[model samples]
Target: MTPKQRRLARRLRQLRVNSGTSLEAAANHLGCKQPKITKIEVCQLGARPDEVRMLCELYGAGRATVESMVTLARTAKTRGWYQVYDESANPENIDFVELETDAVAVSNFEIDLIPGLLQTEDYARAVFKAGLPDISADIIDQRVELRIARRQRVLDGDLSVWAVVTEAALIRAVGGRDVHLAQLTRLLEVATLPNVQFQIIPTRAGEYMAMGVPFWCFRFDDNYGTVALDHLSGTTFLEEEGDVERYRLAFQHLCSTALSKQDSLALLRKYIKEEHSEWERRS
Candidate 1:
């Protein structure tokens, strides 16, 4: 099993253990055998929404808190947004991806490249190459294929995206001519979709709560929200109310300073046209 699967298993175990509760005691709370609890804690089987709710209640989680976990379990089988990397990206913590995919709406405050969920295959590859210079060429190619496949996930889900992008991401040149053009084209196409709303926040707008923090905040049914923050090791999921609230406020502030959706699309078009013009001059 992968680290993610191990983590989910461990988290459930720790929640009980940390409460100074025994397996049998927790099992009684859920009206299940100790072995059943063990199976889920070992990631041997996926937990059902009702069972997950029982576990949360046994752990002393509040109604709002337990409801969130229930929703997570309910939507844990949804298709991943990173379908492009389906073959390459591991399916260890696939439950997390499923939760994001089923989210009714997503709010994002991005400082660099577009949010991964909003990226096209070409744009995703371009960004990946910039940081993963040591990755093998064959591996990079696979990664690109994965990202392209992932981009199509929005079409498969009842997903709505509200995004705020920093001006720097727009100006940065990545993946060379064809790649960048393709990326911009993809963005335009995505923007035209009925559920998507995107805007650009020029650096001149100044800073707010997201002055330096960038995260993908996904909102699900039953008021469940997950904020994934980039870190040195990997991604960290924030469940604490304070952390989630901070991200929500930061996103609101970023949106306050960003261009309106219509103007933002126009800006993207202008940027793309100018870049192509410059490419022709250089060629």
Candidate 2:
């Protein structure tokens, strides 16, 4: 479920609890089955706007809260922009996009490559090519475009981001010297955004808590949050409080071990200059 849907579900459950409305009672009041109520409250099913209104009214929710929840329900039912690309795309990837769209804050830790949100066009293409070499060119292009579109969150200044990347990711040279130079320069530009913070875990910071793990933690308006862990098969989205807390604590440790934002920028600049000199030498 998307963050908005989760928030709506949480709100509905909270209102029902506060009003002491049993699931059976709530379902009877709404002319629905008890399982349907359970589904809506757990975000396994999307609630219609009218359903939200009726539930809020039944739970004695205030007018402002009812309207807010109704709006949330409508949003939860709406399809995200990423859905326009291809319905056949991986469902987990689509879910991540939806979560990212609704997130107010994001924390990312990358080990092997730059985070997709920070990747430049050429750099993204190279990464996609390496991962999906057997795929058709058209599909690869589509994936690259989708990745570029994800950067809208940063460009639109709607989301606050804290990204920590390993030094190896910065110096990997994914698309050769030219692409690496552009990527480094792009990172420098992206880091200047008011809501973006970039840090680097030095190569020397060995034996860390998240050595091989690359994950992202998204924070919504409420205290609710989700974590996405990358694996060989696919991504894993963790919503359990215990799982989220562990990832959050891991991220905190990463932040402390990583170089400061200013120092990271300096490192980026140093690499950028070195890459430029190498390109000049080759030419």
Candidate 3:
């Protein structure tokens, strides 16, 4: 289940508890089996919009909360846009995308490459090629398209993003000089968006916390959030309170140590100029 669905399940369970309604009572009120209520509460089953509305009425929930639950129910039943690439995409990756789509805010710390939501098409293609050298070209193309499609979230102005990227990520030429320069230019363009922010962690900031791996923290309107850790083998989603808090603090530290937004933009421009000079020399 996506984080949104899990959050909705938690809310449903909490509402029942607050109203002193037993599982049997809720099931009876909804005219469903007890196991059905349990499944819905645990996110094993999706609740219908009408069912959510009825439960809210039964629990005497406020208008805002009721509407929110109904919206979550509807969203839970809908398929994610990433489903189109289901054959090529990992299930966990699809789940992460679903959570990202519903997130109100996202915080990412990248050590190796730019986050998928911020990467340019060429840079993304290069990363995919390097990471999955054994994979078929057709599969890589599908992944690249999926990565590019994720950028629409920012373009639509529905999500706010704050990214802390390492200096090495900027310095490394993922798709040769011209492509790398273009990628930097793209970063500068997106950084100007009202909802997007970037911080560059210089090579000088050595031996810092969160240097071991890249991770993304997502925040929702319901105050529940999750952390996704990128590993060589696969991505791991962390939802435990302690794990999430640790990553959150690590991200905070990275932001504090990294360059300010203005300085980060300046740094990107510097890289672009250097790359352009190198490209000119080679040409």
Lowest lDDT 10-residue stretch of candidate 1: 1-10
Candidate 1 Cα RMSD (Å): 5.6
Q: Between 1 and 3, whose lDDT is larger?
A: 3
TM-score of 1: 0.71
TM-score of each: 0.71, 0.85, 0.85
How would you encode candidate 2's per-residue C-alpha lDDT over 1-283 as one tens digit per residue?
A: 6667777887799789889999999999999889999998888998899998999999998888788778878888666789877643577778888888878899999997988898999999998889877878787788888888999889889989999999998779899987888899988999989999999999888878888889999987655578998775788888766788899999999999999999999998998888788779889
Flag the better candidate by TM-score, 1 or 2. 2
lDDT of each: 0.71, 0.87, 0.86
User: Model 1 misses residue 129 by how many Å?
Assistant: 1.7
* lDDT of each residue in 90-113, candidate 3, tens digit only: 888788888888789999998868
Off by over 4 Å in 3: 1-4, 14-39, 54-62, 279-283
Error of 1 at 231 (Å): 3.7
Query: Per-residue error at 137 for model 3, in Å?
Result: 0.8
lDDT score at residue 161, model 2, on the 0-100 scale: 92
